[model samples]
Target: MTTARGDSPADETGGLTRVLVADDQALVRAGFVALLDAQDDIEVVGEADNGEEAVRLTRQLIPDVVLMDIRMPILDGLGATRTIAGEPGLAGVRVVILTTFELDEYVFEALRSGATGFLVKHTEPADLLRAIRVVAAGDALLSPGVTRRLVAQFASHAKQPASGADLAELTDRERDVMTLVAEGLTNAEIAGRLYLSPATARTHVSRILLKLGARDRTQLVVIAYESGLVRPGWQ
Candidate 1:
């Protein structure tokens, strides 16, 4: 469902964003590869046709980002993401789930399983590129509206029970930042809303992540909801 558009010269390896794409459909995979390969800052390092192979290639390639489809043979994207996230050596690698629909049922589970975020298969080429760049730069792809809906819909059924003990670990300021983060505010936006400098806001987020032992901001969002620190339909 990816749309290929304009071409650009390749970037040198020194600063290139290495990526691996895993999808069952050949055409879809090809489209993603073509579009990414044309970007000056990105490079497609490997391709996998199944979840098992996706895990293998991801370990071998050590890609900065993995674009993984939710369904595949031998395993699923959620399983592979869990495997990758649990690996100590691959901690820096970010996984972005690819779904056929924006609100795919497994999207919330995928985020819980350690995905940085997700994108619909039909996402625009430029947006997809920006998502890759964002994830590669250590930011999650969560949009407030979609993420709130998707997580709220499925988080009530989450395997992990609600635990306010997690919230007890944060300072009041960190808690405020976490709430805004669950609302899908970026560091800059959070800074604006809280009347703090962007750097200070980022520090608060970092401290929250450390205190909660969250993998990243995406996981923090999950914690915020499932722990009842933030509730559904609350502005």
Candidate 2:
């Protein structure tokens, strides 16, 4: 639930984003570092050749986001994700899983294992930068199929099936926000859809989190789909 400094408005900040790239291959790690360092607003803080080293670097640097590969030596990405996620006093950190194949089973396991977002190795620079920012801002970068599928699958498996769930008590408006959030709409998109200002949309999102006692959009997504506020395969 706690936020870090980089989440502030982009105008005042100058250093862009600081990131850590963790993968097993030396070539892959180098490529990621080069790509991120190319951006004026993004920086590669460090690189890890294995999952264990990733865990160590994460605790030491606490970058805005960790770009983790699914397969790695010394400890697979899922195990490292669990370690980073379970680490004491590092809840502010966000993990993004990296993969070459979208349908790879490890992608789903990475999510369940604790990644905040995910992307393919061939992701465009613009999208990759945006993903990092989304995670840094405490939002999950769920791009439809990749994120929604897992969300839907997880929701269907829950006991309550999500409808009529108390949400521990959020207002109807807050609940609406949660649904769109699960649908993976950004604040601007949500605002446009709801006919509200961007700032208003942001406020609604924040309030929804507070009301639901949820940490971020990812948790909100879990709540909405699980509670049947939003059923998967909906038109």
- The model with the greatest TM-score is 1
How much is 176 displaced in model 2, in angstroms?
1.1
Reference-based lDDT, residue 186, model 2? 87
How close is every model to the real structure, measured as TM-score? 0.91, 0.78
What are the per-residue Cα lDDT tens digits for candidate 2 across 175-215? 77777887888889888988889899899998886766554
Give the per-residue lDDT digits (tens) of candidate 1, residues 1-235.
Answer: 2221212213346788988899989999999999999998888888888888888877777888999999988888989998998898888999999998877768888888788888999998988998899989997445657877888888878887522336777889999999999998999999999999999999999999888877888888888888888888887
Query: Model 2 clash pairs?
Result: 162-226, 162-227, 163-227
RMSD of each: 4.7, 5.9
Of the candidates shown, which would achieve the greatest lDDT relative to the real structure?
Answer: 1
